[model samples]
Target chain A: MEHSSTVAGNPVHDNHGGTKEIWRTFWILLGLTIVELVLGYIMIGVESTGGRLGLKGAIIILMLAKAFYIVAYFMHLKGEIRNLVMTILVPLSLLLWAIIAFLYEGHSYRNNRNTYDAYTRERSNIQSTDKKADEKGMHEKKRTGAETME
Target chain B: METTTAGLDTKWWNGGKSPFNVEYGKLMMWYFLMSDSFTFGAFLIAYGTVRFSSNGWPDPNAVFKSYPGASETTNAPLVFVSIMTFILIVSSVTMVLAVHAGHERNKKKVATNLIWTIIGGLAFLGCQAWEWNHLHHEGAWWGSNPFANSDGTESTDNFTNFFFTITGFHGFHVLSGVVINIVMLVMTLLGTFEKKGHYLMIEKAGLYWHFVDLVWVFVFTCFYLL
Candidate 1:
């Protein structure tokens, strides 16, 4: 396929070697994917919700490594010139940076929303039910001859 | 060897015989695919941001559960999708075989491998359709997020929207790749590339087919595994 850069009789680029290389990558990808799934199941079974964030990070790292192999070998980008490689990599890195920024901003918003929800729920409960409960406590105190607390 | 003891091969680098050290068609295809990658990347990144933002984001394990002919309440994560992934990967292997056949100028092998790839691609598309129907029955759609799934899990338009959009976009790519494979297969049978003295056309189509497979790996990780 890449006849311009690839020699006609190169071992790995020629007949059996080419197919063998393809199968090898396929196995590696399949194995990595299976490992990812098994780890997910184990974490779920162990009830390790406390370390879920760590597990998520590990999973993502594995995903990135897999992505690299697929692109480098399956796409045949590994043997390309440095310039062509940079042309693809630089933009991808920039994309990653943009995504990271968005993720950070989004997480912050969710945190704020959760905090707001807690505060609002607290205030609403106090208004609707805590008011009557407070009066009942004051009346009991009056009958028992105890001083009313502020 | 194209490279020499003189330190470098300046002949191809000069863009005289082969500019960019790759054929014009192949180079253009790579360029197209690079841009296409950014498009898909952008969609997945957007999905990630929205997912991480939501406190009640639906779990992929729960959301994507269920295989064909299975009840809706089944809890197996990635079972169906794993099969889909396997199919796409097998199609990619067949495409590689086709390119190998081209290298050997075995027109029969090339045509046969291509037909196999086409069958694989079509099977994958059918799988996607089946999966989508199951999802649609469970209340996932183009715009509306159905809250009626059995578990009473909290869902929003964000996750479901991305689910439909990203996979639909990828399904569209599969459709296009299948069409392209059919074209390449026809040309192989007609011996068009043979007359041109090279089966590089098959190799070029193979690149696109492989790329479609590569993108599915990411989609499977993000949408199914994670």
Candidate 2:
């Protein structure tokens, strides 16, 4: 019994030759990574002092770009069998959304703590200042009583 | 004689080929890799959430760098990891070349490319081991930061927790890939792949080798550079 298929007729397998696009994808991935590193340094190190957009945004954007390359090329989900790509992506998208929701909640919780601290500080300051003013008035009254008696 | 006799009569076993009509063995490997991709994706997503929650998190460079002198403040900027990333990408190129060699039925060239890949894999693992060993902490408690509140309290950021876990897991995968390549190289030397009458094993191994490199690209971005 022969273990191998003859070279002439194997209908199940196709010899899809390499295309220019494959090399193009490789170079693009490499170039994009370099761009990502440069942007990361600039955003995190240089612009840390003063920037409306911070390192977080830069990180997220670069990550998404790299993820796009991986999913498109390495994973071959880009030129996949039609249903396969959707099956992979839909669940992944849901996962991303869940992560986003959790992140937002964490941010909200931190912000809430900051707000609470500020409110408490302001309230304490007002109470302390008011008490000091009342003590000053009482001291003046005691002094005036002594002066009037003398 | 017994093994050869046993090999003679099975209708289901087509040497190494699949009996299942649904998919070829190569395609099955692809499916397994896809499932593994989802596992890695979950790790990355969790990593993202931790990073997002940590307000004003230290840069990877700042966190990983070792200051030579007390006055020296600037941290090393992921230089080691960048080199490691380049090495991995080059190995991926070599892996694809090996697959190309396999398709051409040039066993010597396939062996050479696979050796290069194995070398690159080992080099990557060595760098990771060094990086792991170099990690040092100032505080008695591992998570404590130098910057403390007026009450001398530090917020538990848990950055290092994710750092070790994610990178450790990825490192394990890399190690496994290296072992797999070593096995493939041995099989090539033994002419197992040749007698098996298929170059598809090389193709599958190449796919896996490439996937390992691909995963590192993201890990390098998420864990080191970004």
- Clashing residue pairs found in predicted model 2: none
RMSD of each: 12.1, 15.1
Q: Compose the digit string of candidate 2's lDDT tens values, residues B1-226.
A: 5465665436446354333322355566766777777788778777776555444454565555542332324455655676787788777767767776776667899899899999999988887776765452222123423222212223343555666777788889889888988999999989997896656687778768777877787778777665
Model-by-model lDDT, in order?
Answer: 0.72, 0.62
Clashing pairs in 1: none
Highest DockQ scorer: 1
- Give the DockQ (C-alpha) for candidate 2: 0.08
Q: Is the docking of candidate 1 incorrect, acceptable, medium or high quality?
A: incorrect
Q: Write the per-residue lDDT of candidate 1 for residues A56-75, one digit (tens) a residue.
A: 67777877777777777766
- Candidate with the greatest TM-score versus the true structure: 1
Per-residue lDDT for B40-147 in model 1, tens only? 988988887877666555556656667887853467877778789888878888888888888888899999999999999999999999998766655456665543
Q: What total of clashing residue pairs does each candidate reach?
A: 0, 0
The weakest ten consecutive residues by lDDT in model 2 chain B span B144-153
Candidate 2 lDDT score at position B192: 91
